[model samples]
Target: MRLSHLADYAVVLMTAAARYPAGARLSATELAADTGVPLPTTQKLMGQLAGCGLLTSARGAAGGFALALPAADISLADIVEAVEGPIALTLCSDSNNHECILDAHCRVKPHMGVVGNAVRGALGAVSLTELAR
Candidate 1:
């Protein structure tokens, strides 16, 4: 249930972007410097985020990255899913249900669903602008 470093970094990177004046483009190097994340990792995450439509990249000199949409339109869950895929507390809770022996009669699954919903709600309630604050 722990978020990976990349997910955390994605939040940091996006939060930095949120801090910029809306529509302002920032290079990965600038974002990395601003957030204290490494340059290479920032660039990689920036590319991934752009692919996810969370960011837009411009080419050539004086070009960089900018938010594809308004910060208020973006949520923590969106960033998390964009970087880490689905959110599941346990294998039994996973929609894939690959092969969990307890799938038949898992009492915990129901409770886990509640926990998962709470987590999702909490994440969904916070917009990128809230994080920037």
Candidate 2:
């Protein structure tokens, strides 16, 4: 499945953040300028990322948003999932999903979780450090 535009933008914003030295705090406007993402979207995403514990937000003249973990500790899957929720390619793979039209007789339904996990695993293998390069 293709990533939503928001997810893609989140990745872009995160990679730019990763380029900064560890503990370097930056504003959403700075990130928006660095990555070319819209300021409003970047602001919204920064809040979500902070809410999800991927980022830490603070107030004051010297405070802004910073990575809660090292760049290596954050994965592409983390970024994608943070912005778009879990990565479930099919309805069957989504544990909370119960609205399937083919629930009665779908042979491949049982295996979709494995497929979805594999996809997430693949994404998890790529770190922000790698993306920043």
Which tens-of-lDDT digit does each residue in 38-82 have in candidate 2?
999999999999999999999999999999999999999999999
Candidate 1 weakest lDDT stretch, 10 residues: 89-98
Any residue pairs clashing in model 2, and if so which? none
**Over the stretch 16-70, how does candidate 1's per-residue lDDT look in tens digits?**
9999999998999999999999999999999999999999999989689999999
Candidate 1's displacement at residue 71, Å, is 0.8
Off by over 4 Å in 2: none
| lDDT top scorer | 2
Native-structure RMSD, model 1: 1.5
RMSD of each: 1.5, 0.9
Model 1 misplaced stretches (Cα beyond 4 Å): none
Residue pairs in steric clash, candidate 1? none
Q: Which lDDT value does model 2 have at 97? A: 58
lDDT of each: 0.91, 0.93
